[model samples]
Target chain A: MFSGSVWKNIAVLGIVALISGITVFTVHAITKGYIIKSESRYAKRFLFQVAPNANYTNDILTDTINIPKKYFSMLGIESGEIHLVKINGKLISIIVPSIAYDGYNGKIKILVGINLDGSIVSVRVVSHKETQELGDKMEVVKSDWILNFNKKSLNNLEPKSWKVKKYGGYFDQFTGATITPSAIIKQVHETLKYYEMDKSRIIKELDVFNEIKVSNNFEGGN
Target chain B: MYIRSYKSILNNGIWEENQGLILFLGLCPLIAVSNSVVKALGLSIATMFVLLFSNITISLIKKRVSGILKIPIFIIIIATFTTIIELFMKVFMYELYILLGIFIPLIIVNGLILNRAEIFACKNSVVKSAFDGLIFGMGFSAVLITLSAVREILSVGKIFINMDLLFGSAAVDWSITIFSEGYSFLLFMLPPGAFILLGFLIALKNLIDGKVNTLSGNERSSLKKETKRVRTTGPVA
Candidate 1:
């Protein structure tokens, strides 16, 4: 025969289990909608920042890109390296975010947004755990030092011009944070080098910019 | 199964078995994203969702589950709930998810969940155990959020509630600015800040516990004497 108390214990536990399960499920289901919205907004912001200054106002997350599974071998599609910018219907530019290896602390995460014609739109610091005032001052948010790297093409930046003011480059190092600024300039040089070498491949892959097609023309076209 | 008393519910969650501050569970996510208040809040809330459901599901099935296979069953239940939360996190709070990264899935390993399944859910009735799970989860999350808030405020010299973020648009700009632009204290937001704050908080809790016990000690002497007499009498000839 079963133990004297086993049945009683079972009844209590059974009720407890059912109630707990139902309540928790209820809360989770209720909050699911809010959580989804938050995630989409976050991804949208990053997508815009990481891509380019286009009105990429698609229902972004739901908007699927029909990328080939074998996209790995595609040309100008540098995998994790493509930036997309569009203006007036035609694709204006596509810059791949790359790194400059000579950062003072280490390699800085740089997202260099460029146009098809080799003109730079912007370079943002994706991340840098460098020192404050000096090293971390290299951030575009912290100072205009990063802005100086804009527009200057491969031919314009001479190797000797790569140094900071302290090191003789046009860029000024922070009054006390020379290592930080110098590192950024060095990164800028390397970023340009990467872009020069891989521009076509990167642009070809980020088809996010290709929205114009002559589909569904009216039968009464003038 | 019923809330026969209020004190038991509070005590169960607060400390006798705290999720993180005492049990040392979920330390990985607790330490990593705790660099700022906002980051910590996002993670804390996300974790609460996972813990709440997993506890309930595990408790419901405790009777049917084999004692030997209880551990794996607990894991599957916890994993399914965690995955649901993960998908929700990715779709809605993508920024928090990206920042949280591996730590989100690591919730599967949070001793807090396992401990709840092994200790509370499997034994207690559904209603009682669900409250226990919530209370414990909240207590642990409360500690995490508070610690991260302290660290963030000191390090950055600001509190960005971004209420619209976790709450909704209504809470946007709800953040109270404690210190002006230049007042930010950098050290508090770093890794060292976490250890320093954790150590101080532990010391503070211990001190309070000691003080409260001392104040109540006189009334407990008679009870202690009875227990002491039983202990001392047992082994004596």
Candidate 2:
């Protein structure tokens, strides 16, 4: 159903595409396993960064609870994951990998690890599209601005005091970039509040899920 | 098609026709990632792989490609090579991959690759195109490394803080602190600093070219003697 010249063009392009596609597919297949291993290892390291001193007996990588869609919108994500950290079969903290949609340029993905008592263990910006010099100060690599969130949570400060100083709150904003820090502070506080409200339900679900999975693996082995 | 000497091609790309400095083809990553040598080197290697592979592939298929469909074919081929390089780096050099970020994928749009593909590769033999691409890619990497060194020293007061990102853990101590840790001029790390430094680099290239030309018996009048004459009588500031 094509003209002669068009057919020739299509055939040539098709051959090129097929060759390139096969090359990419082969390379991808070769690296697939390694990529998965390294990525999971990297993810584990990131978890350790968020939940410092995590002495988990269970595999934290597999011990994750996918946050329900109802709560994802509140944290600016369609879906989310809350990694469960357990030490000697007792839960210590839950790390929430969240997204802040109010960033100056675009969405800022963050990981917030909260202690059992609702205090923050650590906060890390996983990825952000903030301006290079100004807004980038929020990055822990650039400045210690993010460290200010450590050990502070909803209980320590009033709801109104959770904003950058420019907005009459405690956190310090960057010299020229106020929006980035302010947005992060606001979103982090929201994430903390979400944790507070659903703390019991989420923790209970993780515990039951872990018990069932452990029992299933035990039965399967037998 | 011009069929210049291979030695001239090498010299042209390295000095006279530098893709970065002389031609100013790819400046986005040059300015953005040149804050440190490791980041620059990461991108440099990735770009070199893409350029070399794209050139050779394009040259191989040039005769078969139709006139009207050439651009699309060239772009698709370049993008394929860039994706391969990106995926390879993501697997082996994960940290550097993260550091390079969007610039890795953005290599597809880098004018240097497409420019070389269209202008030189399409008209040349596979071997010649491969050599041209290699020389051109090296020229880009050289400029990137120099810019990175200057910026890293000026801004972070260190030469190669994260050489471990490119090299393994053994090279972690390769970083040399030039001016103590806290002593840095932030201007050199910003985007404007890139523009200023790039301007100086271009000027330096021009100055060297001028000297070389004069030494080779191509005499020109001094800048002072070539000033534009003014007809109006006024105080010359």
Candidate 3:
């Protein structure tokens, strides 16, 4: 029986805490695998949105190239991944995940899929903390503003034309929300420039890695 | 202390002592997540699950716990259940898990859950406490869903939009557009709108209660008998 003594009360509290800790630990253990899978599935869903399923024959989710920390400044993200789109062993495009930290509210995460020819295949806002109704117009579900990025590249537009229309540029900004669109456009432009500069190096690295992987598979079979 | 009847407990939770409407507990999440129905529904279900389990656990251990240590123990139990629900949602309902975000973890601090554990669960039978938690949670959900429905419709001119976030892909078409494109009223999507709409809802509830009371008053007079009033304060009679 639990007594009115101080020690007994402490003991009861300790036991309750222990039981709760165990319960939570058990639940976490059971759900950990599924949680990771679901998270990756969510990330993959956005990747496919930027790089449509019809364009790529490879498993783009697994075919990601982790961007080195040194290139974080160029991508405007702390860390990033670029999913490769390949067909019959030939790399044709890549989806670059970029973040714009100057969103009206906070950072806006976007995925830009670009062809090897440097034109954009498509662009999708993966996540954002921008104001609702005004800044959220960038979403494909809400408006076609994001779709305007399709087929656009640095070559088609002069450096000045890349800014939102409010700032004498090609893209239209929401009536009350220039900051969010401007941030996204700047980040997308920067990501393209990063790709342009590093394209050859990334391809050479991928080719070498692929050759090693193929050789390892051959040896494993033998 | 006297034991409350099952019916009275249910009535107390659902209407007479509704947490959101009357008690006005847990208003933080009530205002924040109620901008959309799916988000409101997600938080409601998560809160209800925690409430039910925590109530049951508290009632079961009430006799063993001393007075001073009761609050901490109840909190630990509630937090444990909240974390468990968060993990479960992450695994199964990943989209909703992402949508609900911080509000799911914030369930531990919801005054409604802790209040029930302290006042009702600690003094009642486990079954009665569990039933109380269920009805109380339903009462809270009723207010949240209503508030969110009004907010969603007024702001976006749509109902059930993005139901798939909570109900999965099969519910993708469940949304119904009430107004044509570009007919949205932005005020209703903001937090200030929630406060104003919630005020109107409370007024409507009071009006309904007044009407019901008058109708019951006539019946009582005809019988010339004193009916037992639903106790809103003090020990159950």
Candidate 4:
């Protein structure tokens, strides 16, 4: 209660804090629109690549893939679920944005679209914090060998079958990127596992993704 | 406050008082975004604009600002101007804005701005501060553009022409080609390449300076010794 003048110090600090806060808020407001557009552009390639067989119009991220209300109960976001792409009244590829956390560095985000029979349409790396030369070679410009993954089936695929040739397995690792290719193979196997485990429910849930936006809007409004 | 001629002004930017290669200000963005010519150019232009405007404003208000609160007042003024340029980039060059990222916000830390505020802005008239800023901006841009050109040519195998995204239709075809076929030196675009190219560029600058010095009867001074002899600063390209 009898200190030397805390009020003066508090007032100065308060003014500085207020000014700094306002400046940050203003900078964010000024940059928000551009940042959103740029991020969307970066992510759009993933959706389109993974679902090449499907026709998408407008900003794809804004549109959602609808899971059937009947099958929605069986699927959890944290647990991973199944959904299908729907064009004007017909069904298309199944959309699967999967997180392969056991990647070379951090989680390698992959959006994989597969036909009901398990043929991959395409794959896109949404985010990956891989190693300098090894894991980063996953990019097409660097080590495009991942292109070999196309058109392969998993019916008789063995676990050991899903590994780098360095370990005497199927896939090839980058020049020095064994872990990256290995992680990719492991994640692909998991994606296939998830698809196979819930095939019947997923099959029943097909042709419902077109209504995703409507459901989302209804939920948001409430 | 008194720049006698063009040579003196050029000397101010290029040597006696440099924003980067000499002054050592703005090293953060200089290192972060020098991976390509387009990005470096985008950031250089933005910084130039901010430096020019803030110098003018600070010089105008130098007399009015109290000694007790000059730094805070100076920061407020610079931040106001920096935000304006950031908004312009966001609206007009969205792709460039995205590539520059957080480094744009970090421009507030750039010592070039503060150096001018403390040195020229606090003492000079508005017109002189503006000239100093303009020369400093040119020097910074020259270094940035040259460094980015070298990087993009070696790493990306191409230079410029993301114009549809950065400058809209007008800049389409504005990009020039340095190569004809597949000849990318990928390592040049990496962060390590930044250090390598920067080392080589500084060496080049020293070589040129040595030649100039030799012509002026100072051939005894070695270029290696010259660069090392002096403390350098931001926009280090």
Candidate 5:
């Protein structure tokens, strides 16, 4: 017990590190598949809520298009993924993950689903840090305020009508939390505008992507 | 190092040296996650898992490690168990994992786990250390669950409202609404409320301890002895 050599301490430390590292690695390897599956299942649950009407046979979790960094500011997100909903191999709708940087407490992440006609299928807040009793009404579990965005589109509402009623707009704002609703209204409007501007390019990219996937499967089958 | 009886060790963990109320260790996650019973329960189970395994592992290896190397070795073991629990939670309890967020990884830094490993587990047998871990974990969880229940009831006017987040769909209807909709006290949901409630809880515990002592007939002398014992920190006697 009196051996206090420096090398001994280092060797003991090394052995402990190696053993603990192996233990963690083994657990991670065992749970990796279930982790991935659970994550996808969670994502799919939200995706379906956003696009309930889409009769897509494809796996929408991986059917995603990455938004270019140039448009990040417009979408209020650092990075973005747009999930394409397909029915019988046809692009039916797209669920875009957007963020509202102007939320009362940091950002509010949402999934906005838009049909091919540019109308909103639905919108669901993925996560947010808004005030508990005030701004949190935006959550579907908390209130129906979020569902008010459904079936609305740019064609119907004037550009000025996008803001909350407090800002001289068509949408109603939470009495005690104007900023929360206004921020979401603005973000949803921007999401609609982004969908309109990128529709053609999005469809073209999907077509190219599907063709490559089909070709890859063809080669693998032979 | 000295050995303690199983009953004394259990009492030391759950009451005499209660990590939450007496030691005041790991208050960061306690305050952050105790707003909801489901969240508190999720973190409690995760922390208890890490603490139990880390204690057993450290006790098993204490003989080989000596001097300054012990702390780092203990940390590595604790972190390995924490990561394993985090991975399992992400796989099996996905919703709770998301709700708990960064706090799960932050379990590695929880002072309670490190304190147990250093002050008790390193000097004890594997079974004793495991018992210590389990009891201390229960002590901490008791505080968290109680705080969360009070907060949930006061702030949201409901108990177990989001039980499904932890127990799956079967618990969806387990919640009990004490007050009608829109009847909430927002203060209890905030951080300051946690501090206020925790203070009252400590006061109540002290009051109870005083009452028990007097009822046992030892009175003031035993109370003084108890405080003196708590004051003498470090490894158990």
Candidate 6:
């Protein structure tokens, strides 16, 4: 079998593939549950950060609505979850995570929390690959530039003002990195507009999401 | 195959054949993640896991691996171990996994692991290969940690800022800020800073090596170049 024959080569390859496949499968099986837990935990952390003051009685982590492609696609993301923030058994606000694809380096993930009246409660940059000092100014830790999105909504700002100040918009883009802030502003504005257009449906979608989760859990339990 | 003493193996890995410093292997990741001590240590541990497991498996199956199928087989084995490490880190050390990002998966192509498999692990016993992997990993990590420390101190005037991400909640206060806010040498945190620091580290390693050789009265020619180079055991083409 150690002979350098074509058949031996194939046999060795087959054995290697089988072993590697089994090893990978074992690891994936062992870590799948914990990985899912960490991901949901991370999402919940962002939820709390975006709407820190929202007195949500329910577990906002579990209460999620999947954004439809028509709305999410414009923001350069394939899909996203709208985490509903409920207070005193009543819906108060929603936290929406969106991606700005035109960012200078790449995609910039932003989470926007909007109040029941459609005004923004807060905005947080969950993740981005922007330039460290310049584009990273979008991060709350780096600068107060991100706070500009707070308390502002589509109704307050004219549609034309969605662009950065360099483009005659209200928001101030970082001095060296205009593309990142401009892209974020444009996409955040669009996300707000999309929410406004389907406000009723988006809110009602939460009930549907809850029902689906309940049924899925019931099916899995059986 | 000639069996070298364990002490010689350790010396070879740590000082003589250090993948990061001596051979200048894996410079890309060495600089990329070495900006922060915790991040470098996290990646180093991940690489160690991959190397250890890949070396053992490759050694165990070395006899069965035909000459023609060696490269593809080694690659599959290395990739499988890398995936295993990545998955484990994502589960237990989720924060570090996210911080290290693509570099975790990119460990398969680090060239260090594959080169070890082709050169040392494939020809050695399982125990020897495992030891080699561990020592080589430590050697590389030493360089990574040193470079990261230099960069972290110079760039931000802080040391161990986020130990909790790698350690735990109890280690949250491990961060040491040498300077207060509003002051930082920002250039050292950037890519160019990484290059400068790495250049100094490589030079330091060479200088030490040269001093040690001269003190021992050993001519450079006494060191076998063949021993330093990894001969190809893969497909000739």
Instruction: Say which candidate scores most in TM-score.
Output: 5
lDDT per residue for candidate 2 within A123-146, as digits (tens), equals 999888786656788777779999
DockQ of model 2, rounded to 2 decimals: 0.36
For candidate 6, report its TM-score: 0.83
Q: Which candidate would rank higher by TM-score, 2 or 3?
A: 3
Q: Rank the candidates by lDDT, best first.
A: 5, 3, 2, 6, 4, 1
Residues A1-222, candidate 6: write the lDDT tens digits. 455587667876887799789978987988899999988887777788777484678788887777777775765677777888887646788888888888888778888888878888888888888766557888886789988888898778999998898889999977777899888898888878877877889767666766887899999999
The C-alpha stretches of model 5 lying farther than 4 A from their native spots are A1-4, A52-54, A206-222, B218-237
Greater TM-score among 1 and 5 belongs to 5
Instruction: Report the lDDT of model 1 for residue A65.
Output: 26
True contacts kept of 2: 0.41
TM-score of chain A of each: 0.62, 0.85, 0.88, 0.72, 0.89, 0.77
Q: List candidate 1 stretches off by more than 4 Å.
A: A1-78, A102-107, A127-145, A154-157, A172-183, A194-222, B1-6, B161-180, B183-187, B221-237
lDDT values for all models: 0.66, 0.86, 0.89, 0.69, 0.90, 0.83
Clashes of 6: 0
* TM-score per candidate: 0.72, 0.84, 0.90, 0.72, 0.91, 0.83
What does DockQ give for each predicted structure?
0.19, 0.36, 0.74, 0.13, 0.77, 0.53
The recovered share of true contacts, given per candidate in order, is 0.19, 0.41, 0.89, 0.11, 0.92, 0.73
- How far off is each candidate at the interface, as Cα RMSD in Å? 7.1, 2.2, 0.9, 5.5, 0.9, 1.4
- Give the clash count for each candidate: 21, 0, 0, 7, 0, 0
Residue range A101-203, candidate 3, lDDT tens digits: 9888887989999988888989999889887887899999899999989889999988999899878999998878899999999998998998898788788
Task: Point out the higher-scoring one by lDDT: 1 or 2.
Answer: 2
Q: Name the runs in model 6 displaced over 4 angstroms.
A: A1-4, A52-55, A66-69, A143-145, A154-179, A203-222, B184-187, B218-237
Better of 4 and 6 by lDDT: 6
lDDT of 2: 0.86
Give one digit per residue, the lDDT tens place, for model 6 in B75-101.
Answer: 998899889888888877788889899
For model 3, residues B111-225, the per-residue Cα lDDT tens digits are 9999999888999999999998999999999999999999999998888989988888899999888989776787899999999999999999899999998887887765554
